[model samples]
Target: MPLLPGAEPYHRRGGPVGVLLCHGFTGAPQALRPWAEHLADAGLTVSVPLLPGHGTRWQDLRVTRWEDWYAELSRELLLLTEECERVFVAGLSMGGGLALRLAAEHGDRIAGVVVVNPSVRSDNPASVLLPVLRHLIPSRPGVVGDIARPDAVEIGYDRYPLNAAWSLARLWREIQRALPRVDQPLLLLRSPRDHVVSPANSALVLARISSIDVTERLCERSFHVATLDHDAELIFEETLEFVRRLAPDAKADDHQG
Candidate 1:
């Protein structure tokens, strides 16, 4: 329940415009550090919280639910509002879903949003099987990958928690229902080869939304883990652009500085 050291407090300066960064499921702040550093360098306050039961061990995730994740992120958003006039939230995969949920619920308050490889619908056909395939997949203790960067965060168990995955499915359905209400500037950065989330899911949200400004950047090389992959720079630039537009006088030159 207490904040993990180097987890809650972000590396930032002078109460600049706030941007809360949430990492993917079963992942630690390591997955989001690059983005946070870039945002911080551009003079923004950034916080990338280690979600409940995350960053310690993969087993910790087994006991946590989606609500636990959302609650922590929402708390950070509320915190950002207290320090800065404009607030932006961004996430990857499961965190992406949470970001959108917050944006939808706090539509008018949020300045903008960015999401990468958002896992709204399972590309796995067995997801149709509901709370069963989760248990069927089984969680591997520590999975590693060959992402373009040297950074490697836990990929979570291969076996899905049927109930957890089922809950995610249900949450996605509800988020879909709330999509039209989000009219803030949004950047949906997705990977064409993301093995976890189908491109169609992003397409569906983009097509349905009526955001005052919307842009979809497609990463051609990386798989689902686009945050730490090659497209990360693109995500960073797009997010900088979003921040500049949403916050008064944030300027195009500010990001480069």
Candidate 2:
């Protein structure tokens, strides 16, 4: 499938400390490009893969399942771990779920995890109907560009593919079962007024995870896509700080300028 302009995956080689960034469902790498570049500029190797079924037409996503997306993330993560001495996984929304799953399965292999308004579970009534509705409906209105910036636009399909949503639900269920196994340091940033993912999702993961080091920050001005929203710089800086505290010898302080 032909990828949309500016939606290509990103990879940059920098230092022994590597970071793998994953975008949310229905979102392209475009959403997290700035964040990846910030880490790369700070001399950290970075990999941001465009998940399967994203950055293309909505119909194409309908045919894909969560496993396909998780496989792509896993591939990039393994590649980074092979070359870097230390590695971290950062994700937004559904990508956060994938990160959590990685931490669960890999244990201390993942140095830490950073998530922005992650969605593990939703109380939306529509979600309950996804299994049956997916068979009858091809798409529904999508929640894209939930940014606080007045003119910012997150270029993704306008329609939400029901079949893919059902697959996402499956991923969520699987991640829930493995939450107790995630012991890596966790940094969770959530927007107070997120219109897409609810705060409960983050709270649920926070309550269940066994990580001894966990920090939660409030993105006061941004929305769901906090990586690209008003608090973007804050997110980038905090991430660097988190990485530095863990890998003190890494040259991550260079990009703080």
Deviation in Å, model 2, residue 68 alpha carbon:
0.5
Q: Model 1: per-residue lDDT, tens digit, 150-200? A: 654434333334555566677788778777877888888888776666787
Alpha carbon deviation, residue 106, candidate 1 (Å): 0.4
RMSD of each: 3.5, 1.6
TM-score for each of the candidates:
0.84, 0.96
Q: How do the residues 116-220 of candidate 2 rate in per-residue lDDT, one tens digit apiece?
A: 998898667678889899999889888888999987788788897999999988898998998999999999999999999988999999999999999999999
Candidate 1: misplaced stretches above 4 Å? 1-13, 132-160, 251-257
All models: lDDT?
0.72, 0.90
Error of 2 at 125 (Å): 2.4
